[model samples]
Target: MATSRGGSNLHWRNSNPATDSIRGGSAQRGIRGGRGSRGGRGGRGGGNASTPKRDPPPEPDIVAHPLGELLQTIRISDLSLEAIKTSKPTDITDLKYVASYNWMEGDAPTIMIPGKPPAWTPLKQPLRLKEDAGTYFRDPNGAQYPRYPAEPAVQAILNSNPTFPTSEIDIFACGSTMGNLLRFVRASSKAFRFSVEVVGKTVFFVRKENSPKEVIENIHGFGHSFPEAYTTWEEDTKGSSSHQRIVQYNFGGLVCVMRFECDGYLRDGTNQVDQKLSSSATSDENDNIIVQALKNTSVSHVFSTTDESLSIKTGGNEVHQQSIFDLKTRSGKYKRDIDMSDFLPVLWLKQIPNFIIAYHDGAGLFRDIRVQDIRNDLRVWGQEHKDDIQQLAVLLNKITKIATEDTRGLLEVYCAGHDLEVRRQHGDGVHSLPHSLRAEWEGMSDEAEESDDSLGATNGHGRSNFSYGDEDENDSSDEDKDFTACSADTCGYCGTCSY
Candidate 1:
């Protein structure tokens, strides 16, 4: 995601004369002259002094018609004048009317008029509303009510629990519509958090949360999909089968590999009080005991295989899985007994950590001249623990096999420990071997010759007139040394011979 800065500024101005006339000029003048004539007089007069005043600027015309006269005849009264007062409170109070004739309550004259009452008719049945019910209505008293039939009564509750031939039932619902039903069941039960329902039968196992503890099965094979779900065992045990009891879990963003050892048998070699495993357990309970065991086990290590680069969480820190293996290399805790070489390809894709490269140098196999500062803390650790070099060599050979072409070539140069003509065949072939490796090898060779000369002098005790060899012979010895150096360069380590 590269971001760019600086851009050309674009300025826009309205060029339409109609828009300009509507905004800045008089509407009446613009209407009379039309759009093209607003600045016509000024522009033409400046160009031609002899141009006339354009027919006396055309007089403003006002032609009166019958509608105008009718509008003039209409009158509007002025209520503000004192002579035009229309409202009188005094006249209203004094107003009275005398009755021309008096009449009693029933003496009023009655006139008969012919009329007929509405004919009797049969009432029609009310219309039936739709299933969703008609719109509700509000009564005059402000209470709102639905205009639908009364709701049906609820079904009677079951007095006894439902039973089946098997303790656990497998229910299979087909079609896309079943998704909603399965989701409903999943949402209704908190105990079925890890339950998965496919298109086929979904076996529902009934297991007690506090069921008797059982042994957890060991995970086998690489590239196994993560478990659908797992449980944690509170108690731990020991022996060869103890590795099987170990679980991997994601804790605090790191992959933790914890074994179910006697409660205090820590992988770090610390000890604590051991928890005893139950001995007198019955075997004829049910198949749910196995399900409960799985539900009760905890993860021992946390790892994510989703990405090409596998990451393991350890010691509360998230790091590459290769780093975890490197740590195991130092601690000698890799009890799984799997060949480390088998995972080199996986690590190569993930990029090998620098510390692992340094470990090879510290093991006193040819120094891994590829890594920067190969003599760091990890290298020193590797030097102190040389017993693991054989395993480390296997991993190194696997890495060399899977490394990029350029990396393989660099490893070859590092192993050769001197510049070779064959290296110049690739990119930057003109460049010499790394100065550090070259200098180190030169110093080692010089020290070796010095030690040899000192040993000879010590062995030739009491000899007086000892003469050194001639210059020509010395040149021959130097040539012999160069030949030996060339022979050593051919010794393959990274599986690539520089010739």
Candidate 2:
């Protein structure tokens, strides 16, 4: 039922109309009340009636009261806009790829496996969109592990041969939580909710997407269908569902870990594997730095499969960061000039360099398709939005500080009309990891602190044996190197029996 759009003026950059000091809640018009029963004075029946009003008394300069003792509210109007805008992010020293994984096509929470993202295999011939309905994932992560959306990433990292260093990380978040905070700092329109929990020094920020079945209304475009027709899941990841990658970076003195879902990657062609998405994605050596890093960490753990409810497998090739891309399909009938401003922030947040916008006629025929490398646009956006980013850093610092100080670990952040409030979680809050993992993580944190202090470390700063690669060739024993070990810790995918 989709249409083809024509004559696309796909400008790589669409200037943002908004200035700084932005906040939500405006353009909310009140409804006109019905005519009064008296039908007198300034009622609807009182035609052309005007009443002379007396001047009201001036209000006092009172402080905005807190919603609750524990509840902390954040509103743009309450803060100094100039100060936040001029604020420069300081002490951001390190940034690196933390860990990555894909939500495999299964369930444990019904064969929850780490399935790498599918490769970009484009088709030469045009095909019917609606007619051929292929399998796809709406919310693969949420659906697979309904308990926690971030569980797979944690599982994947801990399950790898070289376990994660819980002490080094100050924050663990996905694109949703990070985006929500950024949106709040940038004074975006839509309201968002997320959960925050303090696990040792690492504060976990998990996204609360309506529910396990996150409803996406009015998805009538080719966003889903177009990709199905154009890209093909390669041989290794043929049965896999969705891909997600995690990156670690330092911003405003905090070592933050962020996870993001990849749409697909661009190859030289279907046959040529491991090619950069664009010229911008590569240098003289062919592979970009991110690609090499991805290659170093990329490894598979063969897992057992179950029936229809869940299908777990391994042997999927990892797509490098530079080759990854995000795609959007819009109706090309009106020859609309799609803006890049709205899309650039998301791409930058995800570290996605390539963007594809496809236009189709009303009846499912796309011709005006263009692939754009928006690295330059992202750089410009980052420069322009430095204030917003700085505000984000400040806000993050504030949240982390509050969460760390609080005795009760679980907290919820809710923003509606005007105020953004952080309160003690009402119900049983979602746990980031299993009890075993939490214990191990907290134990290691203590160990790292003790180790730092004993070694005359300044302000007790230290890292606990962190490695990017899943399998460390140099450090592995004969059993580990020979793949003879199969514990729940070694292979997170296995529930029991090496599955």
Candidate 3:
């Protein structure tokens, strides 16, 4: 039954103190009865003794100790804070049975030591207790014998599902220490974690089965720029008869490599796709120059042996270098027809010994271009030389421009399939350098395991062991101030809304 709370509940007619006082009632009190004693109560309790009024308990003035000290106390003293922290306190009296409880298992064993100033040690081996006839007792309600007995059915279910399981996160570190540090920071960063879901060491990449309309947009979004190159004709040679050798033209130009490492995870059980999270480093072209150089052979492989002549060294020595570009097709051949766009070449461009620009064609396939390497060198060469590498980068930029502009068209061409041939424009020659000249290495790539996640693409996992601290040790704070959060509408930030 519903009752009307309108007329009688009206303050003017029922509880209006001002009008009541004017009408010969006692002096008016505030709505809360705080101003005078006319109303019933004040604050939490009123003066009426039989009304069963309650008084608030005094709040404890809490002093928190450092985590280490608290942990020591928890281990040494048998004093447990678990009861105080929880609304429902636990009774420690029956803790002897704790060994049988799954919740008792943890990273470190709880050890209680007694002394004037107590000390403790985590047990290397867990304790186990067996119940004998003397230890047996009736159930709390006397409905069953032996207060606690294992339920075989429930135990079976738990065993099948591995209930309350614990896992250890293992790290495999490789690459430069600096790279590893950035990766760790990126994984642990508030901004990166909150915006997207990422498992600690697991990474996933999503490349469209077919090229997207904004494939170039996607690449740039991942923080990479195009490279410049000079116009060159791909030479072709053919002759059924030794007397006649015909030459044909193929494609040639600027080369670039765009390498991106993102912290990500699978969205579904099938792992059909992945959601991209934050990048390990700030979105800067120069950030992964060393990483790109390692992964992209075209960018540096041809000049694999550090040439003293080309290398800038203080004592004049050859700087040996290696690349991340692993071999898939040792001979660089594909059984099925594949397009250049789909073939992301670990190959990139570098200055050749004879002053000629060179690149590891990855068997000279046009589709396998490395974008990041191109962008890194282009920026440096564009800044310093203004004449050589920059000019070449600008020329090569056209290829990417075309690829990006017509992503769908190029993707179609790729799906249809294509082939490239090799021909010699001139005979290879050798150049000698003075002993005083030598090349120096910037970084090294160690063995690493990359996982195949989705879209037939490989995502880098494991840990890297590189030191970025050396690069900005003096001005570490500067690194924090350099990049602002992305302003993209869908961008995920950990806490603050402002990008």
Candidate 4:
């Protein structure tokens, strides 16, 4: 895309009424009296007059990235709030008491969806109470509580154990009612793809391929309706759950697509671990094994591969491996941390492997971009170990394929919002979305889809094959009602809703 338009020369508009209104005026007043000279002399009013002009406020610096896009996705219409009270009074004590009574009784209340993604799920709604729950009634406290019907099917899934089958589950409770409905489909026993609209917002359980045709075709095949309901947000008791907290999925904010790519094995030649792989070594050997693992396993099986050259010899006594594929011309690298802490608080972190897909209505096309920087330290290690070249190649291939698949998946979910344009640039190499990602624009017209024009103009000297088609579905308008933030027609610009 072309750079932003530059500012033009400033031209202040002068508005001096005195010059136009004070045309040649006679010394005499226009008033007519019985006697011509009886009128009092009209005083000549003349003074320099000019309206003072103040400078406009400075524009905020444009720090562009996936974070800004994510923040923009958050809207206040999605939050549901309630009021609470402990005591019941013969007469209404105050507005808080009246509000609490009304809310507890299921009165109309407005929902507020913030523009910021919550750190956890089921974001708490702020409600003020007239009295504490304890003060309502002494013996059998008359305290009121906020309530909603139980989603039985989802509740059942939540009550299960580790190997929960989400095949038909809506675990997110996000439905057509939301902006975009994410349908996560397990393509293989070990790999899955969260499907949505054919635009953006999909997450692949594992990486797949980098071909444009493959990406588009995979997404275009998803069914229209959402699947069954899954688990609801629950507080863990054992403190052993994967998530620190859980909140309801709100469709209003930015839709992100994440994919995992694994290299086959480490390529470092320092150790003779290769002979051991072909030997009678147990699965335990492969558990923490880095470079040598790539040779034996199929590239399609592993999520990410580490390069032998990507190791650091600290103090000349030990070797440390890293998971990053470094590029000479591209702008950055990829991330591969498996631990919850490194990737946890998934919303934060600078080098997490995830793409922030956003739709700018004014622009008429969805933009795909990565949110964080991939680790460079680990990638450098991969480039240094060369003897294990085949393993390194396998690892690179797998990572590239998975990242591309994730880009495609997210575009599908964002289909409800706007048309997608996969940006690619020559020389920018692997870092550009077009080079590293693939996309499918759902429901695009044959003429638009066939034309090379679909590929948006290039920037920084690189070109892309991104397809530009239609805007999002019709917008739903809702101006009144509290408990609900938007009218039933639309989900308040969450991009997840269609009807």
User: Which candidate gets the maximum TM-score versus the true structure?
Assistant: 2
Give one digit per residue, the lDDT tens place, for model 3 in 47-97.
121221233221211111001111001110111222223232111011110
Q: Model 2 over residues 1-499: C-alpha lDDT tens digits?
A: 1222233322222212110011111110111011001000010010011211212211211122112234688776544363355444632344455555554432333222344554444432233344212222224465455444566677666655244677888888887778767777778735666678776568888765443333333234445555544454555554344567777777766888888777676664334432223344333233233223222321221122322223233455545566667776666566664566656766667667677666666556665555666667777888888777676777777788777666556676767646677876553344555555555666666566776655443221122322112223322323553333644233322122222
Candidates in order, TM-scores: namely 0.14, 0.66, 0.13, 0.16
Root mean square deviation (Cα) for candidate 1: 53.0
For candidate 4, write residues 1-76 as lDDT tens digits.
Answer: 1111122111111212211121111111111111100000001001111111112212211221011111012111
* Candidates' C-alpha lDDT: 0.17, 0.51, 0.16, 0.17
| C-alpha lDDT of residue 50 in model 1 | 25
Return the TM-score for candidate 1, rounded to 2 decimals: 0.14
Per-residue error (Å), model 3, residue 288? 39
Clashes of each: 22, 14, 38, 66
lDDT: the better of candidates 1 and 3: 1
Highest lDDT among the candidates is held by which one? 2
Worst 10 residues of 3 by lDDT: 237-246
Please give the TM-score that candidate 4 achieves against the real structure: 0.16
Which segments of model 1 are wrong by more than 4 Å? 1-266, 271-273, 283-291, 295-340, 344-499
The total number of steric clashes, by the backbone 3 Å criterion, in model 2 comes to: 14
